[model samples]
Target: MSRFDENKFRAVTWVQRHIANPLTRRLPFQTVLETTGRKSGLPRRTPVGGRRIGREFWLVSEYGEKSQYVRNIQADPRVRVRIMGKWHTGTAHLVPEDDARARLKSLPRLNSAAVRAVGTNLLTVRVDLTD
Candidate 1:
């Protein structure tokens, strides 16, 4: 990565980790993705913006594999997603072949816009809900 991109990534992640995520995860109506920590053997919940379509929940990771939640999903696809105040179990899949920018068009607009603006290596993730 170039210096600029690396710097941006650091800045964005810092803010998300220390500020945005901590606050959002507490919101009752906020959508949350829960993944088992790859190394810690604990649940890590992240506030995410996505919509559930039938049995699948689709989202784009702005930082791709570099994101901690993505790495956790790589370690274990089993996950839990909270949608509209209800939790559902699922298996997460990282779809590298999908057109992430196009996929974003189908997601919530405000998030898509933020992802488009801040994302450098966008990646699509689909969670197939089991229940």
Candidate 2:
């Protein structure tokens, strides 16, 4: 089987569709965030795991460094997110080394941390939206 089998995928889908709600947005921590490429000028949207910090938000992707989304965010922090029938536009920033490390620790999933360990090699963009 792949990293996550069909059953796991189905369960994840069910959770993303029904179990996760506004009241418990935290339950479904991952989302499909959209952004534009800086150089290519191509439209791109990818599902990634993100976390909200006080007012700002951060997304940690496995392909943070070479990913076009990462490059696009670096070139321009402006971004939009669609979740729970709401659209948001905001400014994004690259998380400093210290902050990135701390964030990796807070993650309950070891897999997430392992992925984040490559964070320095990748790009971690922090998006801040009014909504």
Candidate 3:
């Protein structure tokens, strides 16, 4: 990564981690992705934006592997997602071949717009709702 990209990533991630995420995660309408903390072995919830279709939920990770939640997912694919105040257990799959830009087009607009604007290494994630 170039110096500019690295700097931008640091700035954006800081704001999201400290400010945006804390506020949004508490909202009942906001989608929350829950993962087992790789080190702490505790549940970690992150506010995300995605569209649920049938038994699948699709989302884009703005920071790819650098995102803490994505790293947690890598350690443990088993996860839970809260949608409309309901939680569902699922498995998260990282699709490197998928075009994240195109995938974002089919997701929730406001969040997608933010993701597209601030994302440096966009990656597609699909979660299969098992129950």
Candidate 4:
């Protein structure tokens, strides 16, 4: 990564970890993705933006593999998603072949705009809900 990219990464990470994550996780309307920690073996919840259709939830990760939650999903696909205060179990899939920018257009607007603006390694993810 270039120096600029690295710097942006740090900035975004800091904002998400310290400010965004704490507040968003507490919001009842915020969608949260829960994955088992790859190293610590504990649940890790990340505030995400997505919409559920039938038995699937679609989202685009702004940082793709670099995102901590995405990394956890890589280690363990089995996950849980909290949508509108309800928890649902699912399996996450990283869709590298999909068009992330286009996928974002189909998702919630506010998040899609943020992701498009700050995201450098965009990638698509799909969660297949089990129940």
List the global CA lDDT of all models: 0.97, 0.59, 0.95, 0.94
Runs of candidate 3 exceeding 4 Å displacement: none
Deviation from truth (RMSD, Å), model 2: 7.9
Superposed by TM-score, candidate 2 places the C-alpha of residue 92 at a distance from the truth, in angstroms, of 1.0
Predicted model with the maximum TM-score: 1
When 2 and 4 are scored with lDDT, the better candidate is 4
- TM agreement with the true structure for every prediction: 0.98, 0.60, 0.97, 0.98
- For model 4, what is the alpha-carbon lDDT of residue 61? 89
Flag the better candidate by lDDT, 1 or 2. Answer: 1
Q: What is the C-alpha RMSD of each candidate to the true structure, in Å?
A: 0.5, 7.9, 0.7, 0.7
Please tell me which model should have the higher TM-score, number 2 or number 4.
Answer: 4
- The candidates, ranked best first by lDDT, are 1, 3, 4, 2
User: Which run of 10 residues does model 2 get worst, by summed lDDT?
Assistant: 21-30
List, residue by residue over 56-118, the lDDT tens digit for candidate 2.
666665544555567777787778876543567788777646355556555446636655543
Backbone Cα, N, C clashes tallied per candidate: 0, 3, 0, 0
**Per-residue alpha-carbon lDDT of model 4 for 60-106, expressed as tens digits?**
98888999999999999999999999999999999999999999989
Per residue, candidate 1 scores C-alpha lDDT tens digits across 68-101 of 9999999999999999999999999999999999
User: lDDT, candidate 1, residue 37?
Assistant: 98
Give candidate 2's whole-model lDDT. 0.59
